[model samples]
Every structure is written in structure tokens, then in C-alpha cells.
Target: MISYFNDYANLCFEKFGDRVKYWITFNNPWTHAKVWHSYNKTWRNKQQGMVGISLTSAWGEPVDLTSQKDIEAAERYVQFYLGWFANPIYSGDYPEVMKNYVGRKSAQQGLGMSRLPTFSVQEKSYIKGTSDFLGLSHFTTRYIIQKNYSALKGPSYHTDRDLVELVDPKWPDPGSKWLYSVPWGFRRLLNFIKTQYGNPLIYVTENGVSEKLQCIQLCDEWRIEYLKGYINEMLKDPLTTHMEMVTEIVVPTVFTLCILISAILLMFLLRKHN
Candidate 1:
């Protein structure tokens, strides 16, 4: 599979390599570190195009800020999700917390080895520093609390984390049941990535909400507000100017005029009320 992917990538580089400056080798592959090394070795010098992977994660906040266990669980939540992939690409191994937890669980299950994969010293060195940039996709935040699950629950990803995820009822739910408008979470996740991975070049590959109700609303006020809040939070970071962010919303030409008028009228009304 890896060799096939490499060959396919080589063909792409040979064809559209000149115009395409940035190429994402994979979007959230389960075992991607090896592929990164393979791509870098084969085509980096020849094609001169950057290769990166897109990782999507929601920020996890501790349910109780003062509770140490909840704080640990929140960190664990992120490590299990984002760090599961990012750690190997940047630091060359899975998070220590993940390794310890999974190892303990495997021991309890009478397994010889942990379900989580391991990398050798040389492999670690090779995998480390493989990505040119980190592509992040963030939308919402989850409040996490520590919850102990029996080892009998067995070697599953959710049970292994031993955390409970919750959401605030007050948070705006525009459309998707899972997606809430928690713009602040976007900033927190970005900062976490920056601190955790030495502030690597970041590109927000996906960051938007979906409408649950099927209707033709040209204004798309909810989406507009969502983008406004998230983008504003992103811009608050001084380093954000250096990063590349992408968000796409397609509006038809007929709706374009209607949206412009609505926006102007809304602003005017707000100003008059103020």
C-alpha cells in the first residue's frame, strides 16, 4: 500500500508538480509517519513541493478547572486524538501518557504487547520532523472529566482513554448535533498545537459548521456569525498572520446581492439601536 501510494505520488509530481507548490500526502491517515518518510526520501528534492497531512481535532477542556483529575483527563483526551498522530510526526513517538495507559490496559488484558504501535530508535529519528506543515481542522470543544472504565471493557480507543466528554447546553448549536459554535476552542487548539509542536507552520484545512435544517436562506446568518467568531479568534494571535488558513462558503450570484443588502441593513439597524 505504501509503495503504491509512493508511486502514485511520484506520478502526480511528474505531471502537475510544477504548478502545485503544496501537496498533502494524506488526510488523517492512521499510520502516516512511515509514508511521510517515504515521500520525503523520494520526491522532495526532485519535485520541490511541500508535503503535509491534515489532522482534525476538537479542543478538550477540563470539566472542572480546579480538579486535577479532570485536567489530566482533558489533556489525555487531546493526546489520544491529536497527539496520537501529531506526536509521531513532530516528536517521533506516541505521547508517553498514551503509551503508559495502553500498556497498563494490555497487561490487565493478558496481552503480550499494547495495541498501540511502537517505533524503534532509528524509525523514530526518521519519522520525526517529517511534516513541513500541520494542517488543522477544528470546530468545537468538549468538556472532559475522568471516568474509570473496567479493563473488562477491553482494548478499544474510547475505553482506553478513560474520559467522559460533555458539552454545555448554553453553547450555540447552529446545525450539526456534534458541532457547536465554540469559537474560543479554536484559539485554544491553535495555541496548544503551537506550544506542543514548536509552533510549526499551520494551515486550517477544515473549519466550518453545517446547517441541520434544509432551507434556502441566502443570508446564511449562522454561517456568517460562525466564520466571524472563529476567524476573529484566529486573528487575535500575532503568529496567525504567518499561518495559512482556508474556509470556503459558496453563495450563488442571485443570493450575493441579497446577502449584501441584508448585511448592510442589519448593520444599520444595530447602529441605530446602539
Candidate 2:
């Protein structure tokens, strides 16, 4: 699969290499190290483009500020989700909490080795600095609480974390049921990434909401507010200088183009009938 993707990426670099200066080899590759390494090795010298992966994760806030267990669970929540992928790329291995928790769980389940995979020293070195930048996609926050699952529950990704995710009822629910507007979470997540990964170059690849409504509302006040809050929160972080609100730009442009094409087709059909 790595070789196949490398071949496909090389084709892209050849065809659109001049115009496309940035290439994301994958979007949310839960495992991006090897593929990123392959692309960097094959094309860095040949192409004038930057290669990176897009990782989407929500901020995890502790359900209780005074509870150490809740704080640990919140940290674990982010580690299991974002760190599962980002750690390998930036730091050359998985989060220590992830390894310890999963390893201990694997043993309790009568497994000889960890459920989480390992990398050799050489593999670690190769994968360490493959990415030129980090592409982050964030939406909302989750309240985290510690929840220990029995080994009998089986070895799975969810159970391995031993955490429960919750959301406050007070948060604004614009349209998407799952995505609650928590702009403050965006700032927290950005700062966490900076601290976790030595402040690597970052690009905000995706951040927006979906409207669940019966009618099309062009004004979209909720979306505007969502963008403003998120963008403003991001600006508060000194580490973030540039961000690409992809959905904000792409969706509206596509919708407008579709409407224009439909109107043109309607005009042509009316003339033909006349």
C-alpha cells in the first residue's frame, strides 16, 4: 500500500507539481509515519512541494478542574486520539501514557506483548522528521472523565483509553448535533500542539460546521459566528500566524458555481423551447 501510494503521489507531483506547492499525502492517516517518509524520500529533491498529513482531533477538557483523575483522563483523551497519530510523526513514537496504558491492559488481557505497535531505533529515526508541517483540523471540545474498563471487556481502541467523553448542555448547538461550538477549545488545542511537538509549522486544514435545516439560508449567521470565534481564538495564540479555513472557502464557492451552472442550463433550455 505504501509503494502504491508513493507511485500515485509521484504521478501527482509530475502532473501538477508546478502549480501545486503543497501536497497532503493523506487526510487523517491514523498511521502516517511510513507513508510520509516514503513521500519525503522519493519527492523532496524532485518536487518543489511540501508534504504533510491532516490530523483531526477535538480538545479534551477535564470534567472536574480539582480532580486529578479527570485531568489525567482529559490528557489521555487527547493523547489517544491526536497523539496516536501525531506523536509518531513529530516525536518518532507513541505517547508514553498510551504505551503504558495499552501495554498494561494487554497484559491484564493475558497478551504477551503490547496491543500498541512498536518501532525499531532506525525506523524511529527515519520517521522522526518526515513532515515539513502539521495540518490540524479541529471542531469542538469534549469533557473527559476517567473510566476503567475491565480486561474482560476485550482489547479495543476505545476501552484501551479508559476514559469517558462528555459535553456540556450549555454549549451552543448551531446545526450539527455532534459539533457544539466551543471556540475556546480551538486555542487550547493549538497551544497543546505547539507544546507537544516543539512548535512545528502548522496549517489549519479544516475547521467549520454543517447546517442541519429544512431550508437554505444564505446569510448563515451561525457559521459566520463560528468562524469568527474560532479564528479569533486561534489568533490569540502567538504560534499560529496563518490558518486555512478550507470548508469556509470551498463550500460556498462550490455552491455558488453549482447555482451559476444551473441558471445557465435553465436559460439554454428556455431558449431551445422558444
Candidate 3:
């Protein structure tokens, strides 16, 4: 599977390297990531373009701040979702919390060793220092709590994490039932990426809200306000350094996006200046 990615990216570099200056190796690390490996070895010396990968995660807020377990649960959620992929590329191995918890769960399930897999010392050396930048996609926030349920009896990825995710009912609902506007989570996730990944060159590969398709309203006031809140947060925060771009996409019925079009241009300028 990885070999296929390696072949395709080499073709891309050979064909389009002169045009495409920035390259993202994969959408998520659970998928292909050979471009960074390939580019650094072969194409990068000639192409001179940067290569990185994209990750998506939600900010997990502790359900009970005073509870140490809940605090760790919140941190663990990010590590499992974001750090599971990013940590290996940045630090050359899985997060220690993930190793300990998953390994313990695997043992309880009667496995001789962790089902999560481990890398060789040489493999770690190869994987380390592979990426030049980091791309991330984030939306919303979830309240996390220690899992105390029978779900842990299984050995899937979620069960091993031993955490329950929830949300605040009072959060603002834009247009989609699933997506609530949580601007604060955006900053939290960004800061986490900065600290966890040594403040690498950051690009918000995807960031936006969804509106229900039942109404084809051209003047999307809710979306405008949502962008204002989220983009303003990124502008003021000093933690999210080297931010390249905040990409967005909206799904709806055929309608001229006169309002969102204007909002997007304004956001581009704001992002450029900020």
C-alpha cells in the first residue's frame, strides 16, 4: 500500500514539482505518507518543495477539572486521535500514555504483548525527522470523562482509550445537527499541535462549519459569525505560529454563495495580514 503511494508521488514530483511548491503527503497518517519519505530521498533535492501530512482532531475538554483521571482522559483523547499519527512523525514513536494504556488493555485481553504494534529502533530512526511541516483539520470540542463501562472488554481502538466523549447542550448550534460552533476548541487544538509537534510550520488544512441543506439561504449570517469568531481567535493567539492557511468547504444545494464568497475573501485577507 505504501509502495503505491511512493510510486505515485514520484510521478507527481517528476511531472508537477516545478508548479506545486508545497506538498502534503497524506490526508491522515492512517493512510499513505510516503511522499515525505520519497521527497526527502529523491525528489526534494531537485524539486526543493516542502512535504508534510494532514491530521484531524477535536479538542477534548475535561469533564471534571479537579479530577486527575478526567484530566488525563482529556489529554489521552487528543493523543489517541491526533498524537497517534502526529507523534510518530514528530517524535518517532507513539505517545507514552497510548503505549501504557493500550498495552495494559491488551494484556487484560490475554495478549502476550500490546496489539498496538511497536517499531524497531532502526525504524524509529528512519521515521523520525521525516516531515517538514504539519497540516491539521479540527472542528468542535467534546467533553471527556473516564470510561467506567463494559465497553473495555473488547479490543477496538476506542475501547482501549478508556474514555467517554460528550458535549455541552448549551453550545451554539449553527445549521447542522452534528456540528456546533466551538471556537475555543479551535485554539486549544492549535496550541496542542504547536506544543506536541515542536511548533512546526502549521497549516489549518480544513476548518469550517456545516449548514443544513433544507434551507438554501444565500445570506449565511450564522456562518459569517462562526468564521469571525474562529478566525479572530487564531489572529490574536500567539501560540499558533507559522500558520500557513485555514482551508474551508461548505456543502449545500445549488445556490450562489454571494454571502459566504464575500466572507471567504475577507477571511483570506485577514489570514494574510494576521
Top TM-score prediction, candidate number = 1
The stretch of ten residues in a row with the least summed lDDT in candidate 1 is 241-250
List candidate 2 stretches off by more than 4 Å.
34-42, 216-219, 237-274
Better of 2 and 3 by lDDT: 2
**Model 3: CA > 4 A from native:** 31-33, 150-152, 240-274
Which segments of model 1 are wrong by more than 4 Å? Answer: 38-42, 239-274
- The weakest ten consecutive residues by lDDT in model 3 span 245-254
Give lDDT tens digits, candidate 1, residues 188-240.
88888988999899999999989656776565778888999999999883433
What are the TM-scores, per candidate, against the unseen true structure? Answer: 0.83, 0.82, 0.82
User: Candidate 2 lDDT (Cα, whole model)?
Assistant: 0.85
lDDT of each: 0.85, 0.85, 0.81
lDDT of 2 at 163: 91
Superposed on all Cα atoms, model 3 deviates from the true structure by an RMSD in Å of 12.1
